[model samples]
Target: MKLLLSLSVIIGAIVMASTLTCNVCNFRFLFVCIGSSSTISCTGNCSLTQTFAGSAPFFSQQACDTNCVSNTTTQKENVFGLNYVKTCCSTDLCNSGNSAKLSLSLGLSMLLLWLLKCV
Candidate 1:
């Protein structure tokens, strides 16, 4: 029973830590923001990472391209060669790094943790 409880705790920690996080700036809050950047930890079906690249960036529940997985799009929000890009990915902070490399690292890290716990 003790071993089972310990394993449950470890697994719970892993799950909680594995939640999806995304760069959310000027989003969802009615109050004025103190900074231009912040993070949002999603829950349930809101499990996706969205990134918007533009001079005036914004995101919200309706603004987010929810259910977007492994997709990237480039759009022109202004004149000149400037482009406003919107990207979506799965996993924690995956929009910040190359998804392929991050996936490998995440897999390895989870494996390592499980292995450590076992040994």
Candidate 2:
């Protein structure tokens, strides 16, 4: 019974670790967000969207999305001369400006150790 309880706890930890953490921010004129940026944890994917004015990037937003679709559209608004690119990824901190990679390595490592102890 104790072994089953330990296994359950390890499984729960792995599931919790898989939740996506995205950088949530809105910026204008540059992708390097001008002001403060924050992070959000969600069960879905992380999205990074950028809007362009003519050929120059003018706006950007990053957030946790439930049903984000990845795509690029050109000349979305001819009158406003606007275009956009959106990307969605299912990894922790994927929408952050920095290229740091966060994963369930620690959780998996713990699970492996627990299993070895059981054996």
Candidate 3:
């Protein structure tokens, strides 16, 4: 039983790690916007690219970044004075700039609690 528990915990971590969660927000529809912001709520795999015109949102999982500032040059894109944010994160809902990172944040919290219990 102990071994099984350990295995499960490891598996859970792997699953979480493999899963890519990001906050996707696009305000490109509005031209010459003063201030635009998206609600941080939506969550999905890093492989998602629905808000693009003719390019892949994320080239690969490695392309995703939890630290928004660090990957701003790549993930956080600005076009025509509008923003097309695809904030990617590996650690739960680290992408706090768009509406798709809430669920991942909760999932990360749950995972942490579970790990603590296992210990």
Candidate 4:
């Protein structure tokens, strides 16, 4: 039982330490963001950026960014006629359509189950 518990803990730690993966895609024209067909892994965070003209989003890009920081920067519409917003997250496949919160929840649930079974 002790050995099983140690093995389960090690597996959980390895999963938590794995590199983050993010969707990679670029689209323009409207607010609709098509699902990405490709993905990339990064040591830092995944980034999703969207540009808006007036109040509507017109462009979006998502990919792995080693230097990404979680924040939003907006430009005055009068100066550039557009606004830009970038979101950075650190998690596996966080830049995809799936929510990071959901991923975290599932991971925790699995770990708890494993620990319970071990005990």
Query: Which one is best on TM-score?
Result: 2
Model 4 C-alpha lDDT per residue in residues 1-119, reported as the tens digit of each score: 99999999999888667677787776422433343346776777888877887787776777788888866666555777888788898877776653222233454677699899999
Ranked by lDDT, top first: 2, 4, 1, 3
* lDDT (10s digit) by residue, model 1, range 3-57: 9999999999988875666644432222222234445675422222222444543
Could you say which candidate leads in lDDT?
A: 2
Q: What's the C-alpha lDDT at position 116 in model 1?
A: 100
lDDT of 3 at 81: 31
Best of the two (1, 2) by lDDT = 2
- List the candidate 4 regions with Cα displacement exceeding 4 Å: 1-18, 28-36, 76-80, 98-119
lDDT of candidate 3 at residue 23, scale 0 to 100 = 37
lDDT at 60, model 4? 70
Q: Give the TM-score of each candidate.
A: 0.35, 0.60, 0.29, 0.56
Candidate 2's C-alpha runs over 4 A off are 1-11, 70-75, 98-119
TM-score, structure 3 vs. true: 0.29
- How do all the candidates rank in terms of TM-score, highest first? 2, 4, 1, 3
Scanning candidate 3 in windows of ten residues, the lowest lDDT window is: 26-35
* Sequence-dependent TM-score of model 1: 0.35
